[model samples]
Target: MTTTPDDLAALLASVESDERDLVLSTFTHDDAWRLGCLLVELADERDLPVTIDVRKGPQQVFHAAREGTTPDNDSWVQRKVRVVERFGASSYLVGLRARAKGTTFADQHQLPLQEYAAHGGAFPVRVEGVGIVGVVTVSGLAQGDDHALVTEALRSFLGR
Candidate 1:
């Protein structure tokens, strides 16, 4: 089944009781949408320009933009996949992996461009009772803040 953007929010909105608990408990913290919102909020808080990409693959499941976001030749969807792939590869190339059994890879490394190009991103998504299923990636921000934005969003959205 295709997971539409509306599907995610509406599903989250209607969730309740043990059902909600089951869903929220599986995440290590940040989920994709929360991360996206955090990027926006951070952009506002810091007076920065950012474009957040939350994708499932080459396809962008969610894209959030703040004022003054630059349009790079590389679109958000492409960057999301690269971040996930680079992060995933660090495991084999460098013997790195998530400390937690199924939390995430230790965050992949990427070159930070001043304004364009994909910067910091994440690749770990929590699916409630389903456990970690995919990644929640964001680029076009400071590396640390980029990671924090995603993680913080996850924590806030999960209400945990």
Candidate 2:
């Protein structure tokens, strides 16, 4: 890595414009609110708390709240950032570990990493190779339900 201004500029230019837009556009969608609604519905039904946060490493750009007697998206995102920083690549592994049980996956008969998804909760809104640039988290619900809710919402937007 060089400190030259030209080097930095060249590195920045090396990044594909379309890739940047694809990642950027994924978050800017009006669907974040809709996804928030889905998380809320699941949370209310399960009597759990839900939070949708758009992250760029340790930084959060957008956060939507669904429940809790009080608003605490700020603290929650911080908590998530801490989780990511602490767990690194293993965070998602731990989240899959929190999974309920008897879930099927890559192997014919295998265990999930974390069913509850504690680091992010419920479903995953993360972008692969982006290192958790976004998250949808839930609490007060069973790990299974929590994972289902968040992942379902992710499926909706990620599907389209």
Top model number, lDDT? 1
Q: Candidate 2, after superposition: displacement of residue 68 in Å?
A: 4.6
Error of 2 at 54 (Å): 3.5
* Clashing residue pair totals per candidate (backbone < 3 A): 5, 16
lDDT of 2 at 128: 44
Q: Least accurate stretch of 10 residues (summed lDDT) in model 2?
A: 15-24
Instruction: Return the TM-score for each candidate structure.
Output: 0.50, 0.45
Superposed Cα deviation of residue 62, candidate 1 (Å): 1.6
Off by over 4 Å in 1: 1-35, 56-59, 73-77, 85-119, 128-132
lDDT of each: 0.47, 0.43
Candidate 1 RMSD to the correct structure: 13.3
TM-score of 1: 0.50
lDDT of 2: 0.43
Candidate 1 lDDT by residue in tens digits, 1-160: 6646565444334321222232344432234455566667776888866666664434455676666766651365354445455544211112112222222333332344232223344545546456435556555665445555665665566666
In candidate 2, position 6 carries an lDDT of 61
Query: Highest TM-score among the candidates is held by which one?
Result: 1
lDDT of 2 by residue, 1-160 (tens): 3335564344333322212322323453345556666666656676665565544444444466655624544454455444445444222334443332323222322333232123434222345455335444553334344444555555554553
